[model samples]
Target: MPFTPFHMGAGLAAKALAGRHFSVLTFGIAQLAMDIEPLVGMLRDAPVLHGPTHTYLGAVPIACVTAALAPWLCRPLLRRWNQEVRHYRMPWLQESERWSPQVVLASALAGTFSHVLLDSVMHLDIRPWAPWSDTNGLYATISLSALHLLCMAGMAGGALGWVALQWLRSRRAAQRQRHNP
Candidate 1:
């Protein structure tokens, strides 16, 4: 799942559910950070692609570091994203670049943990409980197609839900304005 957009489905779903409590940008950064080890391994031709960083033990530190740094990294990127949204007249896609420390930390944790969980199911080499165990009990727990489908479903459902919420908010605001005017 290295460099794959599949992980974003979960992030989007989380954003839809948690609203202001979840930062999808932070979550995306954490996901990228989690896959760095595997990307390096692939580049170096190492035997173990999914190494320590793909474990629960490994994810904590990565999540913490990502959370600590995400605010700085995300601000400019989010500003650019919002700019594009405004230029495209997609107000519904606009989002606050600023995130609370709590939201950053939670999003980072969620991203790293979910990355590990999703990869564990698809890759045979991922020892998710590593240091304490080398077993991949989650490997192939479900079919590959099913996993992909689930991720896609999450992406679709989340996008629709977010748009629907935005539409409802706008409608209510319009109704209030009409009544007041």
Candidate 2:
């Protein structure tokens, strides 16, 4: 993807599918973490723009670091967002002081791995299994147009599913309020 939003499609899909079991914030952090090496190389005009960080082997450490740090980093932001966004109170953000280790690990791993696979599909320079092989057979296997569409489709599907889930929750809340009153 050009930046990282293309990767967010999958993260959002994870959120919609797994609900509280998936932490989209941690997943997003991992996406940004994995791209740091490429960004540094781009700024320095290095010979290898993708570098080792773009590989599966390199992503492991990055994902681990991101998973460990994301909770603390996200806490204050989530608190502030919860305060500001009164109508859409985020359950996860309602209190970011705590998080499930399993959720964070799952999200971070998913994020990093997906990022490598997605980039490998488009970037000819990406050797995801480097040191073992330099060839990127996955590259250009599908058209760029198709890849973009796939990412967009994931985003659209996630958005729709989230909206439906939210609507159902709200409706149930309203029904409970009416019955109680």
Error in Å for residue 38 of model 1: 0.7
CA-lDDT, candidates in order = 0.90, 0.82
Quote the positional error of residue 18 for candidate 1 in Å. 1.2
The regions of model 2 sitting more than 4 angstroms off are: 87-97, 173-181
lDDT at 161 for candidate 2? Answer: 82
How big is the positional error of residue 42 in model 1, measured in Å on the Cα after superposition?
A: 0.8
User: Model 1, range 3-47, lDDT digits (tens) per residue?
Assistant: 898888899899888877898889999999998998899899988
Which candidate leads the pack in lDDT?
1
> Evaluated with TM-score, which candidate comes out highest?
1
For model 1 the TM-score comes to 0.91
Residues 81-144, model 2: lDDT tens digits:
6786565764422434457888788889999999999999989889999879898889989998
lDDT of 2 at 119: 92
Q: Which runs in model 1 stand beyond 4 Å of their true positions?
A: 177-181
Clashing pairs in 2: none
